[model samples]
Target: MTAILKTEHLSHRYASTWAIRDINIEIAQSGIVGLLGSNGAGKSTTMNIICGVLNQTEGNVFINGIDLRKNPEEAKKQIGFLPQNPPLYTDLTIDEYLTFCAHLRLIEKNKIRSAVEEAKERCSLGHFSTRLIKNLSGGYRQRVGIAQAIIHKPKLVVMDEPTNGLDPNQLIEARKLIRDIAIEHSVLLSSHILSEINLLCKEIIMIESGRMVFSDSMDAFNNYVQSKAILLRMDNPPAKTEIVKVPGVTQVDVLSEKQYRVYFDGSPEEVTDRLITASVEQGWKIKEIGPDKGLLDDVFKQLSSQSPQ
Candidate 1:
C-alpha cells in the first residue's frame, strides 16, 4: 500500500544547533505508528514539521503523495493534528465548539451539523454535547480535542502525547479512543511511555539526540533483543561456578541469594531441563524458572546511550 505519510532526509535547525537531522519515516495507510524519544530528543520538532506547523531547514514531507513544501494548504487538508496541550475554547459548549471546528475546517454549511454529530459520537461525547468545554473531566476534554481533529475526516491523525496527565482509568479510555481513530485513519503519535507504545503501536520509530536509532515492526523490535536468557529462583541457590559448569551455560548473573539470571547457548527448553535435573540432584529446591524476554527499557537505554550528542 502507498504510504499515507512520508518524510525524507527530514532535518530542522535552530540557528546553530540541529534539532533533528536526516530523519526519515514512512507510515502505511492504516495502523498506529509510534514516535519515541527522551526529552529534547526532537520528537516535538519532527511532529511540528510533519504537521506543517514548522518548516524544515532541509528535507521534504509528503502527505498522501502531495509535496508539503510546494502545496502546503492542500497537504494540510489531509492531516488531523492534536498537540500535547489541545487547542480549545474554554467558554464554548461542546456542541458549539465542535460546530466551530467544523466550519473552520471548511465543511459545507449544510453538512456541518451531521459532521459534528458524527465526530461527537465517534469520540463518545454524545452525552456531553451540551456541557461546557471547561466543565468536563480531563478525559472528556481530550475527547473534545479528538472530536475537533476528526470532524473533517483527515487521512492521517498525528497526536502528540495523547495520554499524558491522565489517571489509570482515563488512560485506558484514551487508548481505546485512539485505537478507534486508527480504524479509519492512519495514526502517528509521539509518546515517551514505552508500555503505551508497546500496547498501541504496530510499528515504532525511535530517535535520540535528533537522529533515528530504531524503526521497525513491533514484532521485529521484540525479536531484536531475543536471547537465551532465563530467570531462576531457588531455595538453595548454587554458586555461580556450579551454575556455569552446566553445559550450554555461557554467563550467570547472581541477582540475589535466591535468584539469578542465567544466559546460555542452544535451545532454551533443553538447557532448562538440564538445569532442573541438576538442581534436583544437588538438592537445590527450585522456586521458579522462566525465559527472560529482555525488557524494553534495556533496549531503549542501549540505543539512547549509543546515539551521538
Candidate 2:
C-alpha cells in the first residue's frame, strides 16, 4: 500500500524535555491508523508536527513525499485536522463558520456555498446548519469541526481525541462519520479509548514518554498478547500458596470459589503438567485449564509502561 505520510527519526522537544524522539512512522493510504496512548504520551505532539502546527526540532516529515520543511504549503494542503478542542467561533452559525473555513482553504468563491452545504449534509448537520455553534451539543460541535476539516477535501485527516466527551449515541454517530470519511481519506486518529482504536484502525502506533514503542496490525498485537498467556483452569481449586509456587507460574487469582487463574512468566510448555502434578500431589482434583484474559491485560500493561529500549 502507498504511504500517505512518513516520518524519519522524527524528534521534538519542549525546552529541555523531549516529547518524542527518534521516531519513524509510516501511515498507509486511505485507512484508519490509531495513535493510542495515555495523556502526555506524545500522540498529540506527533500529530501537531505532522500537520505543521509544530515544527519538529529534528528529523523529516513527508506528506505524500512532499517534505514539510521544504514545501509546507503543499504538504499542509493534503491534510485536514480536528484538534481536541474544536476551534469554532461559538458566535457564528454552522453555515457561517463553515463558509469561513472554505475561504481559508482558498476554495473558489462560486463553489463555496455548495461545498459547505455538502459537508454539512455529510456530517448530518443539515437541521442545525443555521444554529450558532454554542447552541449545538458537544457531539454536534465535533461534527462541525470534522465538516470544516474536510471542507477542502484533503487526502489525509488527523484527529486528536475526536470522541473525548460524547454520550453513547454521539460516540456511535462519530464513529460512523469516521468510517464514512475513511473510505475516501486516510486518517491518523488519537484516543485513549483502546476499544475505539481497535475497532476503527487497521494499524496501531503506540507512543510513551516521547518515544514510539511499537506499531503493528491488530492481529499481530493479539498474537503477541496471546503468546504470553498460560491458560490454567483446574478441575478443583488448589491452595493459593501451591498455585503461586508452581514452576513457571508468576501469579494467581481466584476466578471463583472453585476456579483460579494462573499466570506464568516462563514458557507454558510444562505448565499444564506441572499444575496437574502439583494438584494431584496435594490431593486436589484438576478442573478445566485455560489461560485467562487478565494475563493478556497484564502483558499489555507491562509492555506499555516500559519505555522503548
Candidate 3:
C-alpha cells in the first residue's frame, strides 16, 4: 500500500543555512505516529513542507500516492493541519465557523451542513454549535480547532502540540479525542514531550540538529534507552559509600538527604533486591525504588552521539 505520507530526502534551507537536511519519513498504516524533537530542531519546517504551507528547498513529499509539489491542491485534499496556535474567529459561532471551514475544504454545497454536523459531533462540539467561539473555554475552543481540521474528513491529520496549554482534565479529554480521531484518520502528532509520545504513539520518529536521528516502533525506542540505574527514596537513607559497596554497584548519586540514584552494572532486579535487603538490615526505611529512565536530554545526547556527524 502507498504511504499515507512519505518524504524523500526532505530538506529545506534558509538563505545561508540549512533548516533541515535529507530527512525521510514513511507511514502507511492508520495510527498515531509521533514526531519528536526539541525546539528549533526543524520539526515545524518539515511539517510546513509536508502540509504545503512552505515549499521545500530540495525534496519530494507524496500524500497518499499524489505528488505534493506537482499536484498540491489534489494532494492537500487528503491532508489536514492544526498548528500550535489554532486559527479561530472568536466572533463566529461554532456552527458558523465550522460551516465556513467546510466551504474552505470544498465540501459539496448541499452536503456542507451534514459535514459541519459530523465534525462537530466527532469533536464533541455538537452541543456548542450555536455558542460563540469566544464564549467557550480554551479546551472547547481547541475542540473547535480540531473540528475544522477534520471537517472534510481528510485522510491524514497533522497536529502540532495539540494538548499544549490544556489543563489536566482537558488533556485527558483531548488525548481521548485524538485517539478516537486516529481510529479513522492517520495522525502525525508532534511534541517535544517524551511522556506525551509514549502515551499516544505506537511509532516514533526523532530528529535533532535538523537531521533524522531515530525512527522505529515506540517499544523499540524504549528498549534502546534501557535503564542502567535505579532511583531510591528512603526515610533513613544509607550513605553513598554504603550503596557503592553493594556487589556489582558501579556508582551512587546523592540526589537529596532522602533520595539517591544508584548505578550498577548487574541486572536491576538483582541490585534492587540487594538494596532492599540492605535497607531492612540497616534500618533504612525504603519509600520508593524504581528504574530511572533518565531524562529526555540524556536520550537526545546519547542518540546524537551515535548519529553520523
Candidate 4:
C-alpha cells in the first residue's frame, strides 16, 4: 500500500542555520507513529512542513501519493493537524466552533451538520455542544481541538504533543481517544516524553539536533539497546569482586543490601545462567534476577552518538 505520509530529504532553514536537515519519514495507513525527539530536535519543523503549515527549504512532502508542494489543496484534504497548544476560541460554544471548523474544512453545506455531529460524538463533545469552550476544562477544550482536526475524517492526523499538560486522568483519556481515532485514521503523534512514545506508538522515528537518528518498529528500537545489566536480588549477596569473577561479568552496582545491578559484556542469557549457577554453588541465595532494559536516555545517547555528523 502507498504510505499515508512520506517526506523525501525534508529540510528547512532559518536565516543562516538549518532547522532540520535531510529528514525522511514514511507512515503506514492506520496506526500511531511517534515522532520522538528532545526540545529543539527539528520534530516540530518536520511536522509543520508535512502538514503544510511551513514550506521546507529543501524536500518534498507527499500525502497519500499526492505531492503536497505541487498540489497543496488536494493533498491537504487528506491531512488533519493539532498543534501543541490547541487552537480554540474560548468564547465560542463547542457546536459553534466545530461548525466553523467544518466550514473551514470545506465540507458540503448539506453535510456540515452531520459532520459536526460525528466529530462531536467521536471526541465525546456532544454533551458539551452548547457549552462555551472557556467553560469546559482543559481536557474538554483539547477534545474540541481534536474534534476540529478530524471533523472531515482526514486519512492522516498529525498531533504535536497531544497529551502535553494534561493531568494523569486526562492523559489516560487522551491516549484512549487517540487510539480509537487511529482505528480509522493514521496518526502521527509527536512528543518529547520517552514514556509517552513507548506507550502509544507502533513505530518510532527519532531525531536529534536537527538530524534523523533512528526510525524503525518499536520492538526493533527496544532490542536496539542490548541488555547490558541484570538486576539481581539475593538474601546473602557475595562481594562485588566475587560477582565480577563470573565470565562476561564486567562491573557491579550495589543497589541495596539485598539487590545488585550487575553489568556484563557478553550474552545476557549466558551471564545470567552463570550468575545463577555461581549463586547456587556459593550459597548467595538468589531471590530475584532479571535482565535490565537500559534507560531510554541511554538509548538516545547511543543513537545520537551514532547519528551522521
Candidate 5:
C-alpha cells in the first residue's frame, strides 16, 4: 500500500542551532503511528513540517503522494491537524464553530451542514452543538477540536498531545475516541505517554535531539529487548555461581533474596528450560519463570539519555 505520508531528509534549523536533522518517515495507508520523543526532542518541529505549519529548512514532504512544498494547497487537503492547543472560538457555539470550520475547508454550501453534523456525531458532540466552546470542559473542548479536524474527512490526521492534562476518566474517554477516529483516518499521534503509545500505536517512531533513534513495529521493539533476558523467581534460591553455571546463562544478578535476573545468549525458551531443570536438580523450588518485560521504559530512557544536548 502506498504511504499516506512521507518525509525525506527533513530538517529544521533555528538560526545557528538545528532543531531536527536528517529525519525521514513514512506512514502506510492506514493505522495509528506514534511519534515519541522527550521535550525539545524535535517532535513538534517534525509534526509542524508535515502539517505545513512550519516549512522545513531542508528536504521534502509528501502527503498522499503530493509534494507538500510544490503543491501545498492540494497536499494539505489530504491532512487534518489538531495542534497542542485546539484553535477554537470561545464565543461560538459548538455547532457554529464546526460549521465555520467546514466552510474554511471549502466544503460546498449545500454539503456543509451534513459534514458538520457527521463530524459532530463521530466525535460524540451531537448534544453539545448548542453550547459555547468556552463553556465546555477540557475533554469536551478536545472533542470539538477533533470534530473540526475531521469535518473535511482528510486522509491523514495529525494530533499533538491530544490527551495532555486530561483526568483519568477523561483520558479513558479520549483514548476510545481516538481509536474510533483511527478506523477511518490514518493517525499520526505525538505523545510523551509511553503506555498510551504502547496501547494505541501499531508502529512507533522515536526521535531524539532532532534525529531518528528507533522506528519499527511495537512487537519488534518488545522482541528486541525481550530476547536477551529472563525473569526468575524461586522459593529456595541457589548461589549466584551455581545459577550462572546453567547452560546458555551468560550473566546473573540477584534482584532480591529469592528473585534473580538472568541474562542469556541463546534462545530464551531453551535457556529458561535449562535454568529450570538446573534449579530443580539443586532443590531450588521454582515459583515463577517468565520473559523480562517492561523493557520499553528502559529503552526510552537509554535512548533519550544518549541524545546530544
Candidate 6:
C-alpha cells in the first residue's frame, strides 16, 4: 500500500539541542499509528514538524507524494492537525465555527454547507450546531474541533493527546470517532497515556532522547515480548537454586515469598515439564505459570535501566 505520509531521515533541533534525528517512517493510509513517548520525548516536536507548524532542521516529510519540504502548502492540504488545545472560537456557534474552518481550508463556496453538515454529523455535532462553542461541554467542544478537522475531508489527521482532560464517556466517544476516521484516513495519534494507546492504536512508534527506539505494528510488538520473563504465584516457598539451574531458565527473582518471576526463553514444553517437576519435587505449589512482559512497562523499564542488554 502506498503511504499517505512518509518521512526520510527526519531530524530537528532547537538551537543548540537536538529534538529528533535520523528518523525514517511510513504510515499506511488507513491505520491508527500511536506516537508513544514519555513527556519530553519529542512526540509533539515531531508532530509539529509534520503538520508544518515548525520546520525540520533536516530530512523531509511527504504527504501523498508531495514533499512538505518543497511544497508544504500542497502537502498540508492533505492533513488535518488538532493540537492539545483545539483552536476554537468561544463566541461562535458550532455551525459558524465549522463553516469558518471549511472556508479557511478553501472548500468550494457551494460545497461548504454539505461539507460542514457531513463533518457535524460525523463528529456528533448535529444536535449542538446552533449552540455557542462556549455553551458546550468539554466533550462537545472536542467534537466540534474534530468536526472542524474533517470538514475538508483531509486524508490524514494528526492529533496530540486527543483524550487529554476528557472524562470516561468523552474518551470513549472520542476513541470511537478516531477509529471511525481511521477506516478512511490515516491517524497519527500522540499521547502519553499508554493504556489508551494500547487500546486504540494498531501500531506504535516509541521514541527516547530524540531517537526512535521501537516502531512496529501492535501484533509484532506483542510477538517481541521476550519469553525470558515469567510470572508464577504459589502458596509455598520454592527451591530457587533448582529452578534457576533448569535448562533455559536464566534468572529467578522472588517478587514475594509466594510469587516468583522466572526468566524462561526456551521451548514451552521443555519449560513446563521442568517447572512441573521442580514444583512437585520441592512442594513449590505452583499456581500459575505464564510469559510476562505483556505490558510495555517492564520493557520500558529494562530499556531505561542501566543494565546492559
- The C-alpha lDDT values of all candidates are 0.91, 0.85, 0.91, 0.91, 0.90, 0.84
What is the C-alpha lDDT profile of model 3 across 113-202, one tens digit per residue?
999989989999988889999999989999999999999889999999999999999999999999999999999999988889989999
- lDDT tens per residue, model 6, 181-209: 88888999998777788889989887777
Q: lDDT of candidate 2 vs native?
A: 0.85
Task: Estimate, for each residue in 5-37, the C-alpha lDDT of model 2 and write its tens digit.
Answer: 999999998999999999899976787898988
* Runs of candidate 5 exceeding 4 Å displacement: 227-293, 305-309
TM-score of 3: 0.86
Candidate scoring better on lDDT of 3 and 4: 4
Q: Using Cα atoms with residue i matched to residue i, what is each candidate's TM-score against the true structure?
A: 0.83, 0.79, 0.86, 0.84, 0.81, 0.79
Candidate 5, poorest ten consecutive residues by summed lDDT: 220-229
Best model per lDDT? 4
- Model 1 lDDT per residue over 1-309, tens place: 667999999999999999999999998678899999998899999999999999999999999989999999899889999999999998999999999998889899999999999999999999988889999999999999988889999999999999999999999999999999999999998998788898899899998999999999877776666556888899998898999998999999998889999999998888899899989999778889987644677777877888464
Model 1 accuracy (lDDT, Cα): 0.91
Q: Per-residue lDDT for 58 in model 3? A: 96
Predicted structure 6: lDDT: 0.84
Candidate 1 backbone overlaps, count: 0
lDDT of 4 at 226: 82
Candidates 2 and 3 compared: the better one by lDDT is 3
* Top candidate when judged by TM-score against the true structure: 3
Candidate 5 lDDT over 147-218, as tens digits, reads 988899999999999999999999999999999999989999998778888889999998898899888988
Runs of candidate 3 exceeding 4 Å displacement? 231-263, 272-290, 294-296, 305-309
Better of 4 and 6 by lDDT: 4
Error of 4 at 78 (Å): 0.7
